[model samples]
Target: MSTGQTRSDRKPAPVKMVTTDTGRILRISPEDESARAAVAAAATPAPQNIDPARRTDVLFRVRRAEGHELSSWWMVGAFVVTSGLVIALLSWVPYSA
Candidate 1:
């Protein structure tokens, strides 16, 4: 530690480490604008080292789910049905005149 050093002069921990249920080590970092890009770049596995099914993007799981052919239709239908049901039930409720 040097007395002349300002806060910015010190780089924060590269990444905070975590242990998964499967006993694999993971490095998680706060992903603000600057840190997100930097962490993504740093965490990208080498071509030979990566699993083909895994992705490093922020919404990897969502992106994968988004690939379904009927996902959008299902989402829209669910919203319409739920809202319609709620509104219909409320409309039928007896209100004090």
Candidate 2:
């Protein structure tokens, strides 16, 4: 830190433009410009080292699907059995002459 210069003493830093070999102009911070330049040189990956044949197939188990279907059927069957029991209990009565 400089004793003579404080943050309050300085106006905002000016933007900088850099020209690359491809004729592209990029605006960036002067303080971080060197670090960014170093990164750009080594940032590219070797295409030959990457295998383009890689693929992914996501599959759900057929057994799990069937089990879920059976479970839903069982739930409906339970509801029917419960309703039948309730009806049978309500209809129960003793006949007296």
Candidate 3:
């Protein structure tokens, strides 16, 4: 019985076999290789003029947040609510002897 999927009579495209410098064989489609090359060329950024003297030695700095303090009241409340819910659910379940 057919699964309602139409089978194409067209043959599969031939793939090109390439040998890498590391003696590895790769089977790549011509269309895929060309498209990959095109993408790589497009993704390459142009070189920008950078000043050597103006370059900062520090890459990033980590600092503490000012006036942003966390309170433990919310954590305590959430814990109490979840514990009460678990106890309630356990009590609701019928105990089997």
By TM-score, who's the top model here? 1
Query: What tens-digit string does per-residue lDDT give for candidate 3 at 1-67?
Result: 9999998999889887765433347677866888656654655453356333233543443333676
Relative to the true structure, how large is the alpha-carbon lDDT of every model? Answer: 0.62, 0.63, 0.65
Q: What TM-score does each of the candidates earn? A: 0.35, 0.27, 0.32
**Lowest-sum lDDT 10-residue window in model 2:** 50-59
- Of 1 and 3, the candidate ahead on lDDT is 3
lDDT of 1 at 39: 50
| Model 3 score (lDDT) | 0.65
Candidate 3 residue runs with Cα over 4 Å from true position = 35-97
CA lDDT for candidate 2: 0.63
Clashes of 2: 0
Best by lDDT: 3
Candidate 2: which stretches are off by over 4 Å? 1-10, 39-97
> Taking the tens digit of each residue's C-alpha lDDT, what string does model 2 give over 1-97?
6779556766777887876533357777878778777957856644554333331232442333344555577889999999999878777755521
Shift in Å, residue 84, candidate 3: 77
**Which TM-score value belongs to model 1?**
0.35
**Compared with the true structure, what per-residue lDDT tens digits does model 1 show for residues 1-97?**
7899567767785676755333357667665447545655666345665444564543443324555645588899999999999888888888923
Error of 3 at 20 (Å): 0.7
